[model samples]
Target: MTRTDIASRTIAAPVARVWAALVDPVALTVWLPPEGMSGRFDRYDASPGGSYRLVLTYADASAAPGKTTADSDVVEARFVDVVPGDRVVQAVDFVSDDPAQAGTMTMTWQVTAVEPGTRVVFRADDVPPGISAADHADGMNSSLAQLAAYLEA
Candidate 1:
């Protein structure tokens, strides 16, 4: 099966700034999640052959005892190509206790310096089955909006 998904957003910032926000651990964690959520990059090596992980935590307004409304992750990612201020490609595999999600995915990001600012195109390949493409699209759009807000801040 061939799984391909692409999403794009234009930010009011230069290509270099957008690129930095994407690869920089501090900047990424600051804008990764939605406004209320918090995130952190456990280990990030923004170079080819280097691996990293990101952990995102969401708050649950209503959680009873013994119930959890948060999710944490350690996605193993390695930079495959890094073109400073232009593009980046990374291979990421979800690390979970469940055997079902053990698969590799490639995420490619291309930044074009447009008139207003920068246009970023994100393409994710080899998405696992059972995951809805629509959901991913929506999430990417939401994330892009949040990223724009972060960059403007």
Candidate 2:
């Protein structure tokens, strides 16, 4: 069976600002990684059919092995759809030799204008078996919090 995970947050920012944080490489570098990790993008293009690569490193060397390797996770992603201020969809795959981690995952980020701000919803479909749903949700929530802090600053 395919696994899916969803996370949502309401941020005190306009849809345009939230969308910018979602697509901008610099902003992503600041907020995309979860707690205890940092992210660097090798390439990022926020257009349909555009591809990007990113590496996430754990602050603690003793952290568990990532989907791709020990202490780090590498992702190759292609933009499947991009709608400014509304949504972005991407197909993602991890650079892993482990069969459990070798599959295409679809991630959708949907933004909607709320009374006081914007609501961002994240949906991850076809999650690999190697990823625990609770952990993924925690990471997603952490990233959203980071985005909110960055935008509200």
| lDDT scores in order | 0.75, 0.92
Off by over 4 Å in 2: none
Q: Which has the greatest TM-score?
A: 2
RMSD of each: 3.5, 0.8
lDDT of 2 at 3: 95
lDDT of each residue in 1-153, candidate 2, tens digit only: 999999999999999999989999999989999989999999988889999999999888586667666888999999999999899999999999988888999999999999799999999999999888888999999999999999989
Runs in model 1 deviating more than 4 A are 34-37, 61-70
Evaluated at residue 34, the lDDT of candidate 2 is 95
**Clashing residue pairs in candidate 2 (N, C-alpha, C atoms within 3 angstroms):** none
Q: How far out, in Å, is residue 128 in model 2?
A: 0.4
